[model samples]
Target: MLLWRFVGRTNVILSNGVNWQRHSRVVKSALNRNVPIEKFASLTKRLFSVMGDGGRLLTFSTTLTEASRFILCLLSGTTALGHDFNTIVDNHSPFVAKYNEVMDSIASPLFLVFPKLETWFPRKHVIRKIDDLVNDFGKLLEDKKQRPGNDMLTYMLEEPEMTDEEFRDNMVVFFIAGHDTTAGAMSSFVYYLSKHPEAQVRARKEVVAALGKDEPNIENLRHMPFLQACIRESLRINTPIVSCLSLMVILSPILRAIIPDLCSNGKSYHIPAKASVIMNICAIHYNETYWPNPYKFDPTRFMNQGDGEEARIDASLWLPFALGPRQCPARNFAMYELRTLASMLLQQWEWNLPADSPHHDSIKNGFSPFALSLPKDMDIIFRRVEQ
Candidate 1:
């Protein structure tokens, strides 16, 4: 009920069967077509301009969160809706504010604990705001119909069976997924890099060697193996989403009879006809069996050993983007964004945690109303690198 209130039931993330196929096909194609590297580069440059040069102590958690939101809002808006939110310049954009409000309301601990209270004592104001946001999406769809462009909405309109509600719901899902989660991941990257100067130095060296005074492109990003390892390690140590949404599966009677048990970690349990299973991402990522000294921030685990040997870790163990066909459709896009931004930061500045900062020992988790795990009050001292 809470999720439906936010993204509705028809978005690609939660939808099933033919509906899922249709939504996934269009979303994946749109994301594949639009890489947005130039957009990310330009926006990041603007962000640097806003931050200014020189040795400055900046609060990274706030800065990165806002920058990520602005960049992603523009990216998702332009690609999916053929609109520019202009949130980077105008921080108080009405649409963005309303969207944030809706997300916060959905993440309210009170409502989450007692979901029935929402039904019994309805928050009419929040409901009205949600409806208003949907109506705003409806307006965007109408505008696209009159003035079609090379965007996802234009492509989705080609589907005869698609509904307006489905389109709006998917847009909300894209906004939530592309904005906050990526922001949290970026925060984790900075937190890890700040705490470990060795990893940061190695990553910067690779970035500089690959593309000195040049903008990062897809080919250049591919060559930064150490930087890639840093990203993977950061993701493993602090997965953005601690736990995925519950996945409910209905088992057939015949199948249940044939396979009456499910096994995990040398333990077996009888299966019921229907069960809601939630994947605890944090537990798997930190499991001692899979990762040695799991709490340690070591990027070498992902690095290739000497003599062209590949890392022997199982691919399934890494579930930051999840696994299987239902994996995030925008995985490539998100990775490119991360790599590009990280490269830009490395090229322009050398940053470390402030002497008086609280995160000297460990990265503190921020309070997020949503599923994302964020770094709290991260203040990094950045020195501009001489060209």
Candidate 2:
């Protein structure tokens, strides 16, 4: 009920069967084709501007999080909705505020603990806000109908019988899953880089060699293997989404029939049918068997020594975006965004943790009601690189 109120019943994240297939097909098609490199570059410049022309210390966590959120929102808007919320420049964007409010209400401890309380003591205001947000998306859909473009909404419009409800619901899901997770990822990357200066230097050197004072293009981004490794390592260490949502269940009736009592792999414990299983991503990532010295922040693990190629990562072990058919549709898109932003930041500034930083010893996680890994009190001193 809580999820339905926010993302509706027809979103890709929560929906099942035909609804899931339809949503995933359309969304994956849209995200896969559209990289939006230029958009990422432009928004990155805006972010740099906001960060100031600097050889000074900054509370990077706050600014980076805000910039990442706005950049991702804009990206999602342009690619998904064919609309510009102008959230990057306009900090007080009503739609962004309302969306945040809805998220906050959803993450409320009281409601999370006892969701049934929402039925007893209704959060009418939050529900109304969600409705308004959905209506706003509806307006975007109507606008897109008249002024169609090469975007997700336009593509969905071309579909035989794609409903407005489906469109709006998925848009809400994109807004929810798309931006926050990516922002959290960016934060984790920065946190790791701040702690590991040697890795940061290596990544920056690669970024400079690949993209010398030019914006990151797909061709250039491909050459920066070390930077990509750094991103991968950061994701492994502190994955943005900690665990797959408990709601996402493995409803394999055949498996249930075959192994009626208990199901077990050679390694892990047994699981009964209809069991509520949450794939603990952090545990898998930090497993000593797969990743030797798992706690160390080492990008070299993802690199091939002799060949200038990436090491073959076991997909089963390192699944920050989850695995298999239900993997995040925006995985490639998110990586592109990260690579773009991280490349730009690498080129523009050299950053290290402040001497008095709370995260000097280790990265500290911020409080979040959602299952997101967020860095807190991360102060990095950034020196502007002379062009």
Candidate 3:
């Protein structure tokens, strides 16, 4: 595989089948650690404090993006490194900058196939920076080996089967995925609800009823069904991972030379075995056959419980996190974070898009293959609600 030359084949991002099992186990085990409600509360307070007094407008596009970056960075550091947010921030790390630059450069099709060309392009500096970042992570892992801490890094290091290269690659993968993707989801949640005032009102009411003047906790979050529905709706509408690559197959020359077969398993048809198929998440989500009035932002689609909803849902049809064993390991974490952040936002403040903001108009146009495409200009205002 092309990625093997850059990042070792043992890395979870490139590994497959049996090879991926051990790495998956380590990641799931580490993430399973109880994340205290205090962490969400702390970040919520920081975000709420930044909004300021009435009429002082804020740009959701930039502001929430920054907030998500900080929150995710802090969470990743603490969860993976066992480092405090203050300690991590105080270190003035270059990881975030390098990560942003590398991700942006990788989004281009040129880099997807010929990543080495990144060495010659305008993003040449970023390619080098990413290598440095990966090396730095490797060194961090080495140091942890000498005196391991009780964190995700140490947990993986403790695993006898995990290699140094695999550890470093997994660290980078988790760092990038844990932050940017979750940020995109959170940003979308805020953006979508801002446009759907009725949904916002219902969500806020659900949140307030669940926790009256109390900080958001996992226990309380579970009971707020409407808020959860809104979250699912946001995820369905603006899936963070818009597309993903499927397996590769080799075929005989005769098979390849022919027009190819319309492969089907008594259900939907698939591409020929020789051709690679990119799972189009947006297309699946908008399939009106499964999702009635698909374009409309309606949370009710996921709400009917006793109506045999679980039995009826086609797992293949809705894949915001992708499907199968390779699906997102941190999905539960992402959902909890979105739920907590949205609950806090709605409970404490009344927010809406600026009258002249063009975000709503440009939302559909933002189609990014890397993650959920953000609105062109996300501008909204928040007014603190009286207790």
Candidate 4:
């Protein structure tokens, strides 16, 4: 309830265009200019080089997790930390510790609901540790202020409308949301690629054709159809934000916050006045109403245009990143990382699993009853494609 008052519904931008203008500008400028992709290419290259080694690898493996941690730390540095993307990330021990700790433990939120029993339980440490790590971030931000020029944090601090408390909340939102969702969703992308060989092959062909021996840039990235389809597929199958709503929020001082997706097309979803309501992602995503053969893992479905069957699955059914005003400000940021990582993998390596391994579709608390969908413990072997 408290959080909702601050950020509103995740879909507010979609519904109230006029009111959303400033927030949109702030987010766009923050992501595009402040955290421009150029700063992080070195890290991408480093990761790509590792992919070229043809060594066996797996998602969330200690080594892979460490590499992922560095990339994510770099990502946060540019956006939330607002430091030299390279330097800040390497030196930020607290961030590395926080992120590494977050990854190592995935007890879920039961601890929050059961604090008393947490001590006697296994997951309690995760909560206590995460709280400590958040403090570590607070210190990092404080240290940045006395140092020098303003970065992302500095930019927010300059906002005349934002209070110190609001700024801190946004920071917490950044660290928690930024670290977990991006890495987790991308992990899903990797695991899906490993499990779905046909899609992987087709996706590589598209990457090679679109970027074709050229380094990935924002301009060229727009043309990669297969790569985009793979990303869309990964996001669709594993939505990062399971559900969202602003039903209880008011519009004016008189009426509460306006409901998003209010009477879309002709259908109206009843939103109780002054009550928290949610939009079920999986329900809408996998609904046969929107997607034909919804259960199938087919990226081509997104590419299909001529056939009406494929047309149904078009864009409507996919909601990996929730839509509207409060949607992820870092959608493109996350996508760039996913696409770059994926293209490099497909272009340079062929991934496989142990013959005895079973294809596990991941089991994090997701959609209907829990947190976002995630895939973990996925192991794969890579054979380098010789130049």
Candidate 1 collision pairs: none
Cα RMSD, each candidate: 3.0, 3.1, 4.8, 6.3
In candidate 4 the C-alpha lDDT for residue 153 amounts to 68
Query: lDDT rank, highest first?
Result: 2, 1, 3, 4
Kindly report which residue stretches of model 1 are placed more than 4 angstroms away from their true locations once superposed: 53-63, 148-151, 158-161, 252-265, 307-313
Angstrom error of the Cα, residue 133, model 2: value is 1.7
Q: Report the lDDT tens digits of candidate 1 across residue range 253-315.
A: 644555434334445445565677778888899988889999999888886678322365687
- lDDT at residue 288 of model 3 (Cα atoms): 80
Per-residue lDDT value at 220 in model 1: 83
Q: How well does model 1 score by local distance difference test? A: 0.78
Per-model tally of clashing residue pairs: 0, 0, 0, 8
Q: What is candidate 2's local distance difference test score?
A: 0.79
Q: Which model, 1 or 4, shows the larger TM-score?
A: 1
What's the TM for model 3? 0.81
Candidates in order have lDDT scores of 0.78, 0.79, 0.69, 0.58
Q: Is candidate 3 or candidate 4 better by TM-score?
A: 3
Per-residue lDDT of model 4, residues 1-387, tens digit only? 122222223221332455356545654565565444554555566655544434444322222333454566566665566653352225456555655556445433454456555447555455566666656556766766676353566665554654444445456666555556776676666667777888788777777777677767777666677677777777777676667644453333233223234334655444444555567888777776666777666677667656412234444457676666566777777777777667766766666555544454443332222364544444556666554
> Can you give the lDDT of residue 287 in candidate 2?
86
Error of 4 at 214 (Å): 2.5
Q: What order do you get sorting by TM-score, best first?
A: 2, 1, 3, 4
lDDT of 2 by residue, 1-387 (tens): 565777887878888898889888887777766687887798678767766755554434344566567777877777667787788778778888888877777788888888889999998888888788778888887888899997767877777545788888887877776668887788889878988888888888899988887999989999999899999999999999888866523665645455534334534344555677787899889988889999999888999988967888888888889998889888887899889989999998877776788777777777777788877655556667766
